[model samples]
Target: MNAVLRRHAGYYLPFLALAAVLAVFPLVASTNMVNIGVFALIYGIAAIGLSLLMGLAGQVSLGQAAFFAVGAYTHAILVTRYDVHGLVAAVTAVLAAMLVALLVGLPLLRLRGHFLALATLGLGIIVSVTVRELEYTGGTSGIFGIPKPEFGGRVYDSPREFFWLLVPFVVVGLLMARNLVGSRTGRALSAVNDSEVAAECLGVNTFLLRLKVFVLSAGYAGLAGVFYAYWLAVVSPEAAGFLLSVHFLLMVVLGGLGTVWGAITGAVVVEGLDEGMKALIPRIVPGATGEVQLIAFGVALVLVVILLPGGLAQLWEMAVSRLRRRGSAREPGELPTVAVREGPRDDVPGTGEVSLADLLAEADVPERGTVVLSVRGLTKRYGGVVAVDDVDLDVRAGEILALIGPNGAGKTTCFNMISGVLEPTAGTIEVLGSRVEGRAPHTVADLGATRTFQNLQVFGSSTVLGNVKVARHLRSRSGVVRGMLGLAAREEKEIERSAMASIAALGLAQDADRSVTDLPFGRQRQVEVARALALAPRLLLLDEPMAGLSGAERDELAELLRRARDAGVAVVLVEHDVDAVMALADRVAVLDDGRLIALGTPAEVRNDPAVVAAYLGTDDEADDIVRHAAQEVR
Candidate 1:
């Protein structure tokens, strides 16, 4: 409990203090100011939704106002025409809008960049036009006389009462927003935004996650729509149009893209400034408020984006951090690096060279020779060009199989086909007898064979622990809904612990929280391998895992591969380092011109005439082969 409190105290304490201020502000402020605050809070709820979709998910939505309109129309038509209670109508309205969002978002979410933005913008236009043409929607004018919430024969008719009611929407919305952005799914969203390939290989279903956030953001807009209806007692076509969507987008940008406080800050600042300017400008210089308000908004947004691109939330966080640091400062720290945590390493004296024999004793490991991955006639093509033609391979439960050849030998292509990174042109790929040839990369990962990239695919935006924890997606079943509600706390903690253990086991304990991007090239390569291992794959496909390591590091990798095989994980490596391959692999396959030129135990294949001619070649080519083989890990 203390750990939890200590971790979240920075967030909770300030929130409570702000809540106290908000709770009493209406009582002390003038009626007009109180009314402005209510509108700002309502706008804030929608802004938070936009922030999540755009800032975190890397989606651009321009249909927020349409969702808001859908909510308003649902409530207006239901409550005014059907005599439904206001709160029930509000709930129905939000649900109706979400339903619309669900139907629309399915197709829109698939489009990328400005394509998605334009599609969403089109949705807003369609909603506005449809509402304008419909009689039930009040055509041109919107449905009016929406009822206020009533309980015990008293309506919440006053601005103060409505303010109190809307306050919870803002508070609850922000809390939920914060909750989601900090959860496991939240990290997946960031991972998706940062690198979709990296996230998918870690087993994140990017398309599904994007669709979920899209609908949730729509629901938020819907809630705000219902609030607008109740507060104004009217719903108009203008409420569902382009300008309002632009305003919401402006709020998202002017504050900060993905921040909880920025969402509210943006909404409050934009709405308050516009309304305040309209009131003050007309009195000072009659009938020029709209133009002046636009000018102010343009200038303020430009400055915010140019100066503090993180928005007002970032500025606020910086100020708070500075004030807190003055009272309790620590020495300036260096970027993190991984070191082994003291345990068996300390007890065993001298580096207890972790070997295959020690790892073979682990309880979970299968016996030395179980079937893990089997590929039959695996072929891949690019148009008329055959990349990996009719290759057959097997990786047993406790053995390393190295696929090696010259640069254009299709070694990487064969690995890609097996890992589901590339769909095979013809033939079958399976893990333990289950076919995975046509499946997605994520599906293959979930099926227990995850691959690392030839180039590093670490989540550069996330911490080292975060990168590995994402690969543990299959290990935890607690999902987006449970995570947001904080119901998955126990399971999530276990997942974190497991990720940490994997990091520690890899001798990365000291750098468990470090950014992968901040690490050296060699360390980044290790992080890539560590992330693949963290998936707990039954078959691990490593594309040059020893790429940039030193000689000692390469030896460490050779031992690591042996250790992995001993632990009952099948290992498939595509490597250029011939010496390491010969040392590590139980069997070797050589490819040339997309054909298997040689396949046998290392000694058998090494002496094959086909391998010598195709791979080792003439004196100059053999010299090239020798140079490639001796290319040091680093």
Candidate 2:
């Protein structure tokens, strides 16, 4: 009860204060103050969209103002020139804005960071200039006398009347933003924002997810624009101006980039600042009132960025976490013990004392012997350097192949070429028998192939189970709309259950809810494998998976690989632990200087003079007998 009060205190207090304030301001405030409230509410709606795009998807779009302008003009033109009803015009404006967003986003969302920002800035400039020059859009003079929306024969022509009209939409918009961010779309966006390459390797189509967020954000801006048009009864080029775009961007950053409520809060703060600065600037510097307000906004933004870079929502999160820790923490050495439950398990025929093939027969793992992955003539080059050259490898179902080499032997480079991370200079990669040499990483993953990174890509901000669950993206069918509407609950529950099963298989069930970042390096590696395993791919590529594991952990992982292989999944093992590789791999391939040097059974590779001399080195104990014999014969 106490924790609930503490947690919701901040939430409820702000909501009630804002509601009470907005609810009463129109009743008692002057007309100018009421207009300011209207502006704040309207812009708050736009900021929510920005939050989803910039905050959630890690996309920085600066031309949301263009969307706003497009929407306002769409409604204004439709109603005045075409004899359309206000409701129809409003709906048309929203759909048009969405269409424009879709067209722009498909191309622009691919550009990252400032490049995207600049592209959108240019878009806003273009729209603003075009609107001002077009006679049909009313040129520099703008369009006026836009009709007021009439509902039940009531016309909201006055600011006070419009306030009542717009408040409901503002509420609905906030609710939708919350719902959208909590759904699968939000999950994919979060994964993409963390690392696009890593997310794609896990089967997330980064382009598609980012584009969806972009279009949705634009729709919000457009919706807000429609309302602005109706309220002012006019539309102007200034609505789509570069400065307005900058202003909207600043609000999203100022409040909190990733937080929905932060966007709304940021908008209110910006509007209040605008009004306050205007009123005070005249007294402080009458000669430059309007220009000084811009300066003041710049100064405020700089200070907030310098002092509170995470924005207000992050600040609130940090404070809440601290409070919760204090409230819920037990004294040191006085913690209660958690009881461990035990259940019966019927062992497979060969789990403890038989070969993996026997275990496969007993455990009923898949038995399809189809070739899962086939790589032929794979090669990659960088300028004058050859990274992987003419490499041909075949990975079939139900076997583990260890790729071993000394440092800088291009083992990872070969893996990259096959996994779609690097475009091969000349090669072909076929997964399930279709060429995918130059396909995107996500595309490769879609064809039943996925890989783990050597450096561990854990999405650290999420839970261990969360990390595993996100990897199930390709397996689950519940999408953005279904998730946001809460219709994907069954799929969500199934996903979590599957994640837990994966974790349990890897002996990580104890850390399911733990933040992966809090785990030790060894545990983190386990989580990475768990996430990969969740993909349920026919081919699994593991890079240095045993790098940080202890002797016992390595043995456990070896058994896990056996189970994976027995279940009809092909496993690619890249490791420095020769013993693990010899025990786990059915075949061994060695690379040296971007070329395959040895390919055979582990015993054959160990005994091959070329492999021993090139990889094991002249001083290696594996070649001691040959070296000694040669010296004696000499």
Candidate 3:
């Protein structure tokens, strides 16, 4: 319980600090300053949502102002025309915005990058134009006379009161955002941002997760809009204008991309700067207009992007990190080491090597040998060319099936099809009895199959432990609400423990806290393996897992795979290293020119004439290579 309290204190302490500061601001500031604070707080709310969408989820949106307008208009119409209670109307308005976001996101989120940005930009324009034309919205004038919110018959009318009212919402927003980005769901979001395909391969529903964040961010914008309407006692079409959406984006960018506090900081800086320029620019320039302020913003944005791409939050974090490092300076030439658990190992007699047979014999583990992955007549065609043709295979538990072929022989393509990264042009795939040929990767993963990529898909922005924890996403049951409420603490701790075990299994426990990008190429591959192992899948597909490894690293990885197989995991390894394939595989499936040429025990496949021909084209050199590899395996 003390551990849990300590964990939670780290999150809430900042909230209390923020709350205390907000509580004191109104007491000390003048009325104009208080009014500015209100605007900053409102924009801060919207910016927080934007930060989650773009900074964390790696999604871009230009339709946030549309949701903002939806909230303001909905609240204003509800209170003035329908005489709804202010608080109830506020809640309804936020829901309305979220509903609109759901509707828009269903179709719009399908597009990515600039396409999604432009689609949202168009949505903002459409909302702006629609509000101007709609009669109930009061045309271009927009709905007005929005009543102030009341609690127990006490109205919040003054800027000071409104500022105080807004503070709690900001605090709640920050707390929620902070909690979310630090939870399992947040790690999944970071995974999605880093690589959607990889995230899906780990059983993270990328599309659904993206949609949820979109809806949640829209809610934030809508709530801000509700406050905007009440505070101004008016709503206008301009409230949903494209410019306002740009401003929200700008605020998030300037403060920090992925940091929770960055959102609020950005809003305060941008809002404060805008007001300051409006008051100061004319006095300095004698005949300056709002256009000059726009120029100033443009210059500021360029400077921030060029010098501090991670934003002001990143700058502050760097400074703090540097200060801490200086305070705890290590002695020259001394290195930090973390204890790594290498797990139990068995060595083959006279070879000083860990062989598959040795591992199988040493462990008293039972072999289930149940077929976990069944692929029938799998084919992939690229317009006029067949990348993979009529491949049939089955991978059973407690076995390692190495899929090997020469370059362009469709080994990776076969893995892609089975893992659902690519839809088979023809044929069916069943993962643990579920038909999964054309399904999304996440669905296949959900059915107890997971895979690594030919190109490493480690989340470069995260630590090694963080990367592994993301693999445990499907194992946990936390959603945005639970995460935001800090109710997922126990589950998160369990996930970390599990992830750490996997890391330790791969001898990466020492590097658990290190950023994956800082590791060497070979170690990064181990990180990928550790992440895959963390999934605890029945079927594991590895595409070139030993590509960048040294001989020692390869041996360690082979041992790890043997251990996994001993524990009933069916691993399909696509690798070019013939020696590793011959030594480690229970069965070898050889592909040639998009066709499966041979499937049998590693020794059988290695000596097969078809396999030799496919690899070396019936040459004496090819025969020698195969013979030598076979001898090495023995």
Worst 10 residues of 2 by lDDT: 339-348
For model 2, residues 144-228, the per-residue Cα lDDT tens digits are 9898889988989888998878877876677667767767778777877776777898889888888878888888999999999
Cα lDDT of model 1 by residue, 1-634, tens digit: 5655676687677567657777898999899998988888888888889999998789998889999999989999999999987778889999998899999988888899999999999999999999999997899988888778776677778999888877766776787788888788888888888778778877888888889888889899999998899899999999898999998988888888778678888988888877776677667776775778677657766876889878787788799999986856655784423453333322222334332233223224445687788888988889999988898877888888888899988988887777777889999988777898978778877777788888778888888878888877877786667766777766666556566656665567688767778888888888778777777777888998888888988887787787787677889889887878876788889999999988888777766888888886657767565455445321
Model 3 per-residue lDDT tens digits across residues 35-103: 999999998999999999998778999989999999999999999998998878999999999999999
- Candidate lDDT scores, in order, read 0.80, 0.81, 0.86
Model 2 vs. true fold: TM: 0.90
Cα-based lDDT at residue 493, candidate 2 = 58
In model 2, how many backbone clashes occur? 0
Give every collision pair in model 3: none
Best by lDDT: 3
Better of 2 and 3 by TM-score: 3
Estimate TM-scores for all models.
0.90, 0.90, 0.93
Return the TM-score for candidate 3, rounded to 2 decimals. Answer: 0.93
Where is the poorest 10-residue window by lDDT in model 1?
Answer: 342-351
The residue pairs in collision within model 1 are 338-511, 549-633, 549-634
